[model samples]
Target: MDVEADVIVIGSGPAGLTAALHAHESGARNVLLLEREEELGGILKQCIHNGFGLEQFKKDYTGPEYAERLIEELEKTNVQCFLNTMVVSLSPDRTITAVSPEKGVFHIKSRSVVLAMGCRERPRSSINIPGTRPAGVYTAGVAQRFVNIDGYLPGKEVVILGSGDIGLIMARRLTLEGARVKGVYEIMDYPGGLKRNIVQCLNDFDIPLYLSHTVTEIQGKERVEGVVVSKVDQKMNSISGSEQSIPCDTLLLSVGLIPENELSKEAGVELTPITKGPVTTETMETRVPGIFSCGNVSTVFDLVDYVAETGMIAAGNAARFAAGDWKKGRNPVEIIPGENVRMLFPQRYSFKDDLILFVRSAKPIEKPVNIELSPLGMRLKRLYARPNEMIRFKVSRDKLKAVTGPIEVSITER
Candidate 1:
């Protein structure tokens, strides 16, 4: 069967939910939201924690509560939502191919589309840790689902690798669930998660956090028995005499996240090597016009509030595009990451409106730092910055008058 909508949103995560709601509110009738999962919340349904909604709603809410709130608001709108629907392919011309057990196979032709499929955790195979095929090895996200959703304890003794937010959160979660957490080990010299997580999840719980350490070997035949931990030098080469044995039944990995962009590739959207996400303009529209990207699909965002914010940006512009109120063919300016800046999004600027930039630092830097934007001479100061936390700043359209060419963003230390 064939369907049509003014706006089509893929994925029912925070970004997609917000995009669909805002698109309908922005005057796009027939907004269609498709979700692959049986539920509407995406990963949030399994995230039973409470550190959400502070930024967007000014209230601290558990993951399910936040999702329920959004779902409630969406029910009030005219957005048409379909759960258990998997979008198999997306076309540059706004054609979507999806399959569902109920609908069999269907196609959707939309005036505009939003990509908000989010991201996935890096598994043990991605890190290539030398280990036997064991049953106790799982990504932090999988462990979270097992405990929070499936009502099963993963293991009694857990050894967490990587200090990413999920790993850190799981370290505490597993500990609270009667699991003896040996420690959280990180290959990096610094923590991978936010300072708040490090403090609340590790420091407060009296759990040890070992920096510049890695698990060299997982020793187990059937289930996990133990792991060989080793200290690494600045270059991440394990030191010969720094090996230690730690007995643990389970190993959790939270090394990194990769944006889900297979559909983006099918649509021939240009992606950045740095972010592994689609190249977007200031309005969050991808290289393929009428198609937009947001949330973790744009980049592995640290906060859900920003994820929803990007959805609004994408939806507002998508509604305009669907209504033929958008102007095309403008000279796009490049936004470059300079010294001490690791990643920057919205690589292209239209210079038509104000812009918000998301930035990540190359390394952790102490107080008295300034985020400097060249050519336009815009600067924002911060007390401290780290690669784990993203920095957000805005540039007004009025400032574009001073920018003759590309903009270089960098972190300047005092």
Candidate 2:
């Protein structure tokens, strides 16, 4: 069969749901959402943690509760949601090929599409961890799903690698569930999780955090038995004779996250080297005219509120683009990261509206620094910054009229 939509949002997570809602509210007649999972809310389904929705809802909520609230608001309208539907391919012409058990196979032609497939965890293979084949190793997110949703314990004794937000949260989770957490190890000198998470999940539970340390060898032929932790020098190489064996049955890794953009590649969208997601305009439109991207598909964010915000921006622009009223500004400026910055999203912009540039610092800056637009005199000062959390700079279009050539953002100490 054939289907059509004015706006087609993929992945019914917070981003996708909010995008579809915004598209409909912005005057799109036909909005549809397709989710590969059995239900809506994406990863939030298994994330039973309580540190969500504070920015959007002005109150804290568990993951499922936040999902339910968005779904409830979505259901109040007429946006159609197809669960267990996988979008197999997308074309530059905006034709989506999706498959489902009930529908057999179908094609959707859309005026505009919002890609919000979110991101996946970087696994052990990505980091090249030396280890025997074992059954007890899992990503921190996968272990969270097992414990929170499936009601199964992954292991009794755990040693977590990469003190990311998920890993940090799981440290507390496992400890509260009667599991013995040996310690949390990070290759970076600073904790990889947010400041609040580092305090609440690790320090509150009396869990030791070993920075500049990494697991060099995994010791097990079957289930995970232990890991050889080694301290790394300033250059990130393992120092000789610093190996310490930590006994544990399970290894939960939270090395990093990768944006899922295989379909974006299929659609021939330009991707940024830093964000590893699609290169987009300030409106969140990919180089391809009618397609849009947001949320983790663009860049992994620290909070769900920012994810929803990007979704809203993408959807509104999608509606405008579908209606043949999408505006383009005069000067097209390329945004780049300077010395202390790691990744910057919306790498290209035209100042269509008030723009929010999302960026991550390369390292921790304890002193006050200026977030500057080089040669244009736009600067925002901040007291502290870290790699785990992204820095957002919202600048008005009028403020950018003076900027010529490319706009580069640098964090410099005052």
Candidate 3:
């Protein structure tokens, strides 16, 4: 099969769904959306918890409900959507090779492409936690799918490693499902999830959270029988003589998330080491012209609202590119991460329009700190900052009207 479109979105997640809708709204005549999964909701289908859509829609909603709202809006558009379609390859020239049961092999040539494939959970093998080949080890997402979607429980007793949002939520979920949650252990001194999740999911449930701790080993053969937990120092090395054996039937890992950038790499798109996502400009355009990336595929966002926001930005730019109206920055200004800033997005600014800068702190900082934008002498006061919670600020073009140099973002005590 061979087809063509004005814009082709490569996933059916919240990002891709929004991208397709925005592409149509942006005047893309032929917008095509493809999803590898049988469903259109992506990971949100299995995420049964609430606390979503608060910022985007100004109302709280469950993950599925949030996705349903997006899907409903998408249905109102003329964008064509295909499910159970796996895009195998993407060319830099905006050619996509995909396969499906109905269309065994197909090629889609688009004027522009929007990559919103989102992200995936980091598995146990990635971290190399010493353990036997056990049947009870599962990533937090997989376990969530099993329980929430497939109507099956992983085990009766569970010990989760990593204090990520998913792990924290799963602790409460498993507890409510009659599973005995041992505790959640984190190698970092600070929790890896939002403060609200730590409070609502773990704290409210009376689940213990152990900081600066890790699972040194998994003690099981056929199935998980127990786990060996240990404390770690600042360097993250296991502290000797601090091992404690905890009996459990299952182990869940919520280590981290990595952008699904296999297609981006295949297309020769530049990727940043920190975000593990494509390097994009302020318009969410990749280095390769006519190709845009957004959502968790750019970075693991804390909120789905931000993911949709990026999709709109990328789709609008993609539509502009397709119409030959895309504007390029003149000598784009570089944005550098300064003191206590772990990561920053839109590494380069066009300096022609207002830009939203996303920043992540290197470590936890106390309240009354200032987020300083250098070279402009601009500062925004924040109560506190954490590596888990991202910082977003807008840099107006008025401030860059006379500036012709790079800008640095840093965090300092006020």
RMSD (CA, angstroms), candidate 2: 1.0
TM-score, structure 1 vs. true: 0.98
**Model 2: number of backbone collisions:** 0
Model 2: how far residue 369 lies from native, Å: 0.8
RMSD (CA, angstroms), candidate 1: 1.0
For every model shown, the clashing-pair count is 0, 0, 1
Error of 2 at 204 (Å): 1.5
Model 1 per-residue lDDT at 350? 84
Model 3 C-alpha lDDT versus the unseen true structure? 0.91
Residue 408 local lDDT, model 2: 88
Candidate 3, residues 254-288: lDDT per residue as tens digits? 99999999999999999998688988878898889
Q: After aligning candidate 3 to the native by TM-score, how far in Å is the CA of 341 from where it should be?
A: 0.7
TM-score of each: 0.98, 0.98, 0.98
State the lDDT of candidate 2 residue by residue for 1-414, as single tens digits: 299989999998889989999999999889999999898999999888898999999989999999999999999999999999999999999999999998978999999999999999999999999979798999999999999988899999999999999999999999999998989999999999988988999899999999999999999888999999999999999999999998899999999999999999999998887998999878999999889999999999999999999999999999998888876656678988887989888888776877798888898998888888887777899997778889987988888877778888888888
